[model samples]
Target: MRSTFDFQPLFRSTIGFDRMLDTLESASRVTSIDTWPPYDIVRTSEDDYRISMAVAGLTEADLTITQEQNMLLVAGQKSEQDEASGQYLHRGIAARAFRRRFELADHVKVVSANLVNGLLTIDLKRELPEEMKPRRIAIAAGEALPKAMTKQIEAEKQAA
Candidate 1:
């Protein structure tokens, strides 16, 4: 037995759906991607965010964080160690090199990075330009008014 799927009707009914198709393709591709050094992304404020990754047994000197072309890349490689004479019975820790990439939005800047308690924390802040912020406009009357009245109005507006 075989099952057939039909998407033409659904696709035709949707409006401005190019983005939807692109998102679907991306999602399908990401599922097969590898997941290592598990991470967490949190929004601390309206324009502030933090990304934490579990990097046990990894030191600051071994890790590298960089932002290139709107993408944040974190990579780590352990240093070579002296040969051990005795054989270990059990070795559970991971010391392998890892490279993790994160897609960042525009205007997002990496503020700082710190390693504490086997975790790597990276802070990011989004800075919007002055023109992007909301502002209030003062409406003036079309007819000419007295100079004293205009001065008084300007002073009151400034005080407000």
Candidate 2:
């Protein structure tokens, strides 16, 4: 079973959210479900995050992490090696190539990545620019306006 949604109504009401809505619609329509190399996303702090993936039988050389714009790509490619000829009773380990993508919020950046004990941990932090941060605006109490504002006000009064 599949379902679809109409975003035309939302388009008229929302502003600067087309990309997010498009992402949601595309994700809903995706038919393939790939869950290999399971990963976990955790918020370590207010602006810090961590992603841990269970990548058994994979080494540092077999994995690649890249960050482009607001997207994070993690891919793993196993090196070609000759396997033992002996027949095994049971083969449980998975050593396959995979590519995973993660969407990042604005200002979020990858800090570091480390692989230890078959686990890959990626750390991220959100560092908002000074202009984007919330600032306190001081209120004037019965004081004269600045020269620029006073001049503009006088000009407007004269024009009127």
Candidate 3:
């Protein structure tokens, strides 16, 4: 059974949240979940993240990683030599091609990707722009405003 949520009420009060709401609604729908080539997502620090995926039997030439806007795509395809290497009595390891997609937040960028020991590790870091970073503003005391106001008040009184 699929449950549908009405976002009319939220739309009336919220602004610039349509994309988030659409993501939530689409995630709620039922679909075939692919679990092949297991992966792990870990947060190393406040602004650093790591994604490790098990891509056994796949070499650097067999994999492709792309970062487009807010999406990260990872795909792997077994080499032709591996498929015709030998006949196995009991086939176990998955050699099928697979594609994975990850949604990245604004300011989050892929730093590097490395393949080692059947594991592909991808590093991510979030770097906010200077204008978006928090900044401290100096507060002025009452006397500071009065000084400027007093000059204006004196000028007006002289004119009168």
Candidate 4:
């Protein structure tokens, strides 16, 4: 089942949240579109993450991972398939091309990707920029306000 949410009413009550709303709406639309080659997104630590994909019968040469802006994409193409000239009673395993996209938050980046034992393990870490990271905003103790600024403050106080 697909979820359809109307965000127009929410927009009227909020500001500076257009990006977030758009991201959520887009995510809801994309989730219902595809479900091939199962994958899992796990948060390992406070700022670390890992995406493990079950890609059995796949190799390193067939997988591609890329990060564009705040988006992470994982695509795989089966380069080697069973080209045998025999008839099989039951064909079950799927070795097909797939493309998976993830909407990553700011500061998150792909640290490394390793394919071990048919599992594509992608590691990610959030390294916030110095300016974006929160720090102490120290207030100067006993510092007097400038004459003009103090005059404006006094005027506002008297009016109030």
| Per-prediction TM-score | 0.68, 0.79, 0.84, 0.73
| Reference-based lDDT, residue 149, model 4 | 39
The lowest-lDDT stretch of 10 consecutive residues in candidate 1 is 149-158
Q: What would the TM-score be for candidate 2 when compared with the true structure?
A: 0.79
Instruction: List, residue by residue over 4-108, the lDDT tens digit for candidate 1.
Output: 434457677898775555545555553556677889999999999999999988888889999996689999987666125457688787778999988777679
| lDDT for residue 98 in candidate 2, whole number 0-100 | 99
Compared with the true structure, the alpha-carbon lDDT of candidate 3 equals 0.91
Evaluated at residue 80, the lDDT of candidate 3 is: 87
lDDT of 3 at 115: 99
Clashes of 2: 0
Candidate 4's displacement at residue 127, Å, is 1.3
Best by TM-score: 3
**Residue 113 shift from truth in candidate 2, angstroms:** 0.5
Ten-residue region with minimum lDDT total, candidate 4: 149-158
Compared with the true structure, what per-residue lDDT tens digits does model 2 show for residues 1-160?
4378878799999999998898888777847889999999999999999999999888899999999999999999877762345576887988779999999998999999999999999999999999999999998789785667344344444554
Please write out the lDDT profile of model 3 over residues 35-148, one tens digit for every residue: 988999999999999999999989999999999998999999988888888888997888899999999988999999999999999999999999999999998766543444
RMSD of each: 12.5, 8.4, 6.9, 7.0
Whole-model lDDT for model 1 versus the true structure?
A: 0.82
Lowest lDDT 10-mer window, candidate 3?
144-153
Clashes of 1: 0
Task: Rank the candidate models, highest TM-score first.
Answer: 3, 2, 4, 1
